[model samples]
Target: MQKIMLTGATGLLGRTLYKTLVKDFEVVGTGFNRATPPLYQLDLGNQQAVIDFLEQHQPDALIHAAAERKPDVCENEPEQTIALNVAASEFLAKQCAQRDIALIFISTDYVFDGKTPPYLESAQANPLNLYGQSKQRAEQAVLAHSTRHSIIRVPVLYGDVSELAESAVSVIATQISATQTTAHDNWAVRYPTHVEDIAFTLRDLLKRPENLGGIFHISDNQAMSKYDMACIMADILGYPQSLLEPLDEPSQSAARPHDCALADSRLKQLGIAHGREFKEALKSILLTA
Candidate 1:
């Protein structure tokens, strides 16, 4: 079995990926605080710690899922964001390169300014926030340091209870369940992807390391606004749509990209299978809960 090293194994995506990977490979998962199978407490920002960990484990592949995901938080701590997102990633990529291990970097759709619709892989990135900028810088560092690297850019993700409030759809679902009203009448547009699909896609990519290298956009095919997504969730949950209310976008504090939809044509063309529609994915998650 291939030995895999995964960072951020405690995170939403990281946890899901870890659970799935352990089923098929020899997986060593790492987190800053939490402990799980093959879990380590090493800080990636600590160069010596990272190097020592790599030297000790020496996994065949490295999947980096760790990052300060909150845009506002990143804005508040730019230095910390850069250290984890860019500097640490560079160190990992270099180490992986030296060992001829495949490096997989999880990136975000926020790298785009959301000026255009259905962003393609070839489009130029113009991040509007510190988080996006840091991720973009990290991607650049990974690419520059390692030729055998795959950068998978994911949009909004939802799955499992852990990702609920963190996910736009889950947040709306919980709000509608509580207040019986739509909270996001007017917010922003994005393509929501299921975490399971992301994990499966990563697994497949690892199997075909050569074909999956470089940047790839992974997201559901359909795009919808926050208001529409909320209404759909209410409908799926058998809640009355009257409870849904739309809010104006200008009323929000954080500057969100209005149309951050990603195009998954490349994924399809490459024969990468994706799972359920946004509504179906949300329904399955609620049922499993």
Candidate 2:
């Protein structure tokens, strides 16, 4: 079995992938703040720690799912964001290159400035926020430093949360479940891709690492505003739709893209199709959760 090491093991994507891929491969997952069985604590920002971990584990592949994702946090802590997102990414890519191990870097749709409708893998990155800039830099590092690497770009993600209000969808579900009225931002459009599908896609990508290398977009091919998502959530949970209200997009310190929907034509050509529609995926998650 291929020995695989995954970063951000305690994160939504990392934990999901670990649960799905553990039976198929020898998986070692790592997290910073939280450490559990099969997952050890490591500071990715510390080059020595990362190098030592990689040398010790000697995994055949590494899936980099760790990042400073919050826009406000990234904006406030630009240096820290660079430490984890760019420097750590470059170091990991270099180590993987020397070890001849396959590397998969998880990226984001925020790299685009939301000027275009449906972004492809080849689209030029024009990030609006520090978070997006950090991820885009990490993508470039993977491309420059790694010999065998794949960059997977994803959009707004939702899944079973370990904590309350982990994702926007979960927050919506929580708010609507308790209160009769809830307000949602109607401006920015998003593609609510499920974490399970991304995990499944990574599993499939592992089967053909060579073919899947380079940049690829994998998102549920549906575009809906946040208000629309709230409506769907309300409907799914049997909550009153009348309680949902559209509110203007709140002013933010960080600039976010208006629309970051992705099209995976390349993934389809490679026989890797996204699993389900947004609503169906959301329904499945709600039922299972």
TM-score leader? 2
lDDT of 1 by residue, 9-98 (tens): 888788899989888889999999776546878688788888888889889899999988888788788888888888888888888898
Evaluate model 2: give its TM-score: 0.93
Q: Can you write out model 2's per-residue Cα lDDT over 183-234, one digit (the tens) per residue? A: 8888788888888899988888887766756888989867787789889988
Where does candidate 2 stray beyond 4 Å? 177-180, 248-250, 287-289
Query: In order, what lDDT does every prediction score?
Result: 0.82, 0.85
Report lDDT (Cα) of residue 111, candidate 1. 93
lDDT at residue 20 of model 2 (Cα atoms): 87
Q: What C-alpha lDDT does candidate 1 achieve relative to the native structure?
A: 0.82
User: Which 10-residue window in model 2 sums to the lowest lDDT?
Assistant: 170-179
Q: Provide the RMSD of all predictions against the true structure, rounded to 1 decimal.
A: 2.1, 1.8
Backbone clashes in model 2? 0
> Which pairs of residues have clashing backbones in candidate 2?
none
lDDT of 1 at 25: 87
Judged by lDDT against the true structure, how good is candidate 2? 0.85
Alpha-carbon RMSD, candidate 2? 1.8
